[model samples]
Target: MSLDYLVAQPVLEAERFILRPVRKSDTGLISHYASDERVARMTTSIAHPLPPGAVDAFVARAMAEDRSEDVWVIDGTREGGAELKGIIGLKRMDRNQSEVGYWVAPPFWNTGLASDALQLLVGSNPLKNDTMFASVFQDNPASARVLTHCGFKYLGDAESFSVARDATVPTWTYSRKL
Candidate 1:
């Protein structure tokens, strides 16, 4: 289903930042952060050494009329923070379900930015989903803590391909009922 007409992306507020829809002007900062190996390797999609035009294509997809996912940038400029702290998104699924994904720039790591962003998104529940699912690579316990700290229950273990790692990585899945 196309969310372009069904659901309007909302700007969600948080104490430290706001979760706003991605825009064309965000490409440069996003590229700068996602290009970092430390950031890219942690995500399932972002390829390490981020190729040219990769971020532009990503922004295009986020703004597409028929997009399957709703992406938001963690903007902190409202409080004189970095304009682009990172990204958080929800990939639509059937049965009023959606999968959550997020990343924080290396500089923003350990600052509770990811946790705050995830909490804001979950609290907002923009898609009005019945349930929201999330997973983090087992190697990244910090992200797992972010989910659990936000009240997500551990579901089980799984594996997902990491483009940056170029291999299947073990993941811990978690879910929360909205």
Candidate 2:
């Protein structure tokens, strides 16, 4: 997509959740869910025992006009779902590609929220991306399932530093041609 087209981020809707841009009011819930060690350790960015103001800073980045990534909160209020079940985002890469990432609050695990959210985002192709990439820590089979269910083919194995784990973790890389 062209720069002009990419500038305006859109709110995505699924049957059970609404993928909307982050708002100032969401900081508390973001901090609440992300602060959990279980939630933070599974991903690359969120740190365990989340430092003060981390959510605020993340919110600011997500809301930035020139941000390279487009983030959406998995808001389920419309369907009487949890206000914040998780978050999903796409970081723009070269050649009409984007990297997808997401995490689900523990309360919503095994409830198909993650899978639904993944399908919603992949189906929308909100960034108008020609390709989408993703990676999941090898230990997180559910995440890998979500990606494969959405048609992402395994690319290779790699390692990424986890801020929460404080160690480099093995990851399985996957990609999909949109």
User: Against the true structure, whose TM-score is highest?
Assistant: 1
TM-scores, all models, native as reference: 0.95, 0.95
Stretches of model 2 off by over 4 angstroms after superposition: 1-7
lDDT of 1 by residue, 125-148 (tens): 999999999999999999999999
What is candidate 1's CA lDDT for residue 21?
89
lDDT of each: 0.93, 0.91
What is the TM-score of candidate 1?
Answer: 0.95
Worst 10 residues of 1 by lDDT: 1-10
Q: lDDT by residue for model 2 over 89-162, one digit each (tens)?
A: 99999999999999999999999888888888989998899999999999999899999988999999999999
Candidate 2 — which pairs collide? none
* Clashes per model (N, Cα, C within 3 A): 0, 0
